[model samples]
Target: MIRKTSLIAVGVVAALGISLWGGSAMAQGDSYTIKFGNVISAGDTQNQGYALFADLVKERSDGRIKVQVYPDSQLGGEREMIEATQFGDIEMTAPSVGVLANFDKSLEVFDFPFIFEDAETAYKVLDSELGDEMLAGLQNSGLIALGWGENGFRNLAMVKGTVKTPDEMKGIKLRTMQVPMHIAYWRSIGAAPTPMPFPEVFTSLQQGVVDGVENPYELLYSAKFTEPAHYLTETRHIYDPEVILISKDFFEGLSAEDQKIIQGAADEMVAKIRSLKATISDEIRAKIVAAGGTVTDLTDAERQQWIDSAIPFYKENASKVDTEKLKAILEAAGNTTYLEAIQ
Candidate 1:
């Protein structure tokens, strides 16, 4: 009778163990919702990549996680959305590195004019240890940096005339993103830099609030800025990168497995965004031309002139950002000339 009673007790314990294990597993699978927001249009390259990320996360998590992407500032403008993410009011956002620099000053290095000669160089630096360190800096500000997304190279689009060199931009009232580095650079070069929100740019250009605005060709074309500002120059001045951000609070609350799923999907999103970006400039330039806009490419000499003009701006502002990190980016891009000049 004692042996039989012991066996029955063992059976009850086994059943209890199984029940507890099942309950824990179910708890581990608790559902989560990520509200991903961006200022880009619904079908823009960035949004498309974000959509892929959302899909991948949901599929990988077996529907335990759902990501809802709100694009075109549906949630709010970039700055607003960034703050929302920081406070966990929203789950995610991707903002220009320049805009993000407002929250984490270290990112200002990317806003310097002509910091990168090409997209490949930008990618090399941003995917390196230095870039990761810079991204990690966001944690103090309550953001989780996923990966860098490209906004391509910002070029000039003028309403009246082509601006191929710094000399051409003198006294030209230009609209700029309200980034300090951007404003400082344009102001240093004698342009009347007008800081304004993105939504106001089109009308600002149309109503003569500004003579020209600078952005990637894709944005200029898509936003119909190329229509009002028909003179497009391939200055490729600044390589604007968007930073994928999440709320640190929200991210920490996630299960490790779900966090891995979200992060892995972000990595894939970066790759896909870049792959689509590889040819987007040329493609959009064609579209701009097809739409009755004149596009101009700088001669090697003109490009060099633009670079030289940036020296004063760099010398003045480089000291304001993290010198070591800036040096790393320059080294990564093989821009020894600039590194030497800045020092």
Candidate 2:
């Protein structure tokens, strides 16, 4: 009788233990939603990569995590969205390194004009230990950076005439992002740099609020900035890289498994964006010309002239920011001339 009672007690305890374990598992299966905002248009390659990230996260999480993307400055411009992300009002944002440098001064290295000659060289610096350190440093600012995303090289799009040589940039009222380094560089070349928000760029161009704007070909074409700014120049002055950022509080609160899912998805998303960007500049250049826009290619001499224009700006400002980080990027990019000049 005693033996039978002990067996019965053990069976009841085992059944209750299983029931409690099942309940705990159910409790762990909570769902989360992410709001991702950017200035990229809906069908652009950046948005395409963002959409892929959303899909990958949801599928991998078995629909436990959902990401809603707001593009075309729907959630406001890059600065506003970055603020939103920091405050945890929004979950994510991808802002250009120039704009982001406003929050973290270490990122100002990329703001220097012509630091990178091509995307491959830029990628070499960005994917290195130095880049990871920079991204990791964002945690102190209440944000977590996933990885670097591309904005490609910035070129000139003018309202009337094409600017090939530095001399031609004189007195040209140009629109630039609210980045001090950019404004300083353009001003050094004698251009009047007007800092404005991205949303106002089109109307600013149309109403002559600004004489011209600079960006990658895809952005100029997709945003229809080329409609008013008909003269396109392959200045390729700045290699812009955007950071994939999430709210530190929001990210830290997620389960470890969920965090892994998000990080993996972001990695893939960046890769997709880069792959799409490889031939996009050329493809969009053709589209712009077909749409009755004038595209200009600088001669080798003209290009050398443009490269040389940044030297004075570098000599003046190199010691102002993180000189070692700047040196690392310049050295990695094979811009030995710039590295030596800054020294």
Candidate 3:
């Protein structure tokens, strides 16, 4: 009878242990390994922010979650990475809002040229209710949009000469991101816009396939595009914010605790990325000049001319997007002219 009782007690204890272990396993939900990808170099600000996110997730999750970052299109270009994330083939990507707009048409308003005066105004719009509403639309596209990251203001870098006035852009074969609004704006301004992937811009510039390219100073200097296209103009034509995205399906499968960690890290990343970008333009402009690229700035008059040139573009394309959201962004940016015109 003593032996029988002892065996029964052992079986009860074993069953209890198994139940506890299974509950714990279910709570953690099959340790997730996130594959994060981007098109920038490993040392770029975006990557720095992503690395921080990965570190925070690993430390906070007690090593249950592992994040691996693939920079410089190692996974693929922005569009491809986004698609991969949507299909659950990859885990995450930070794509320029322009690229993301192709998937969520509501985001297309962000691609409008000369819409934002500076990073501060851009941030105000993106951090407001309007931005959250736009981000919320991503659920339909299979992406869970995190907060916004910065691409900084895109400037013109040419192989031939500096472009100050809108007329100066005439007939220049400028390489543009494969975003329709961007292409349309350039075409309206009289430039022959050549749409291509980010990876192709540098070689196209070097080979004379495209006479010039436009991007943030950080990208131009980091990617060595300024080496081939020596004339850099501080056009500040567009304020592009990259949207940090993850697979909605994968995100939903995680425990609520893990979800909080991922979301918190993403918020931290936005702050880090914007802080870095806030001060990086001047630093990179100096680097470009030191590397023998000619850097030029527009006069106040020239800047106004650039702004005025976009009126026609805004008129034709503003109706293509959600006008109410566009108005909200304009109101947030204090773009009274465009806002009034649209209204």
Candidate 4:
């Protein structure tokens, strides 16, 4: 009887071992790798912020997941990358919200010329109910908007001359991202807004295909947009948003735990990127000045001129965008000027 009991116990232990091994195999099989790609140059604030995301995911997953980052347009421009993510060919991409608005016009509200006056105001709106509602629009486009990142306030840099006032921008050729509102805004102000990829701007400026490009101080320094466009204008005319977008298909495929892990990491990285940008404006503008390029800050009156000039633009393009959505944003601004929403 003792021998028979011992044999039964051994059989139970053997079954348990097989079950545990099968469970391990199942867990391994369920793991999926994600590729995170961006157009930003490596080591810039965007990439530094993105690194924080990668580290968080690895720590959270304990190595069950991997996020591979491809920077510097090694894959393609923001538009191309977004398409890749949509089709699930690539897992993720973050484009400046300007290009992203093309995929989902609801985001064009962010494209509103001079919508955000400061990052704090932007943060309040972006982190609030308004931002969440806007982000939800991405699901239909096959994108999961992870979190907001920073592109900061955009300033104009020109190869031709320093623009100290609205009049100075007249007849000047400027390069803008491929966004309609931005192009229209510049056109209204009498500057030719050329649309192209971030990578191609340097060559376009070098070849004199375009006279100027506009971006925040950080991008101007990192992308070397200032070298080709020697005159820097702190126009800050358009306040744009940069966003981190993950493929909805891939994100939805992950377990709920993994989904939270991926999103939580991006949330944490936004503050870091914003903090880094906050401290760099003066220093970056100074660096450009030290290099013998002219850096001009618009006077308060000059700044208002840029703002007032957008009135005609809004009248024309606001209808061109979704009127219902525009009403929501306008209502958010208290039915005042679009500038009120950001300020």
Candidate 3 least-lDDT 10 residues: 17-26
lDDT of 2 at 176: 96
Q: Positional deviation of 44 in candidate 1, in angstroms?
A: 1.5
Query: Which ten-residue region of model 1 has the weakest summed lDDT?
Result: 18-27
Relative to the true structure, how large is the alpha-carbon lDDT of every model?
A: 0.83, 0.87, 0.84, 0.76
Across residues 1-343, which tens digit of lDDT does each residue of candidate 1 receive?
0123323543454434322221332234788688998878776788889999999999999998999999877887889999998876888999999899999988888888887888888888887777777787787897878888888999899998888889878899999888998999999988999988888899989999999999988888877899899999999889999999987656555555666788899999999999999988888888888888899999999999999998888788889988888888888899876798888
- Candidate 4, residue 43: CA error in Å? 1.7
What's the distance in Å from true for residue 192, model 4? 1.4
Question: What tens digits encode model 4's per-residue C-alpha lDDT throughout 231-303?
Answer: 8888777777887887765655544456567777888888778888888888887888788878877789888
Per-residue lDDT for 215 in model 2? Answer: 93
**Candidate 1 segments whose C-alpha is farther than 4 A from its true place:** 1-27
Best by lDDT: 2
TM-score of each: 0.91, 0.92, 0.91, 0.87
Regions of candidate 3 where Cα sits further than 4 Å from its true position = 1-29
- Candidate rank order under TM-score: 2, 3, 1, 4
Q: For residues 1-343, what per-residue lDDT tens digits would candidate 2 score against the true structure?
A: 0123323543454434322211332123578689999999899999999999999999999999999999999999999999999987899999999999999999998899988878998888889877787776677787878889999999999997877899998999999999999999999999999999999999999999999999989998899999999999998999999999988666655555666788899999999999999999989999999999989998999999998898988999999899999998888789987899988
Better of 1 and 4 by lDDT: 1
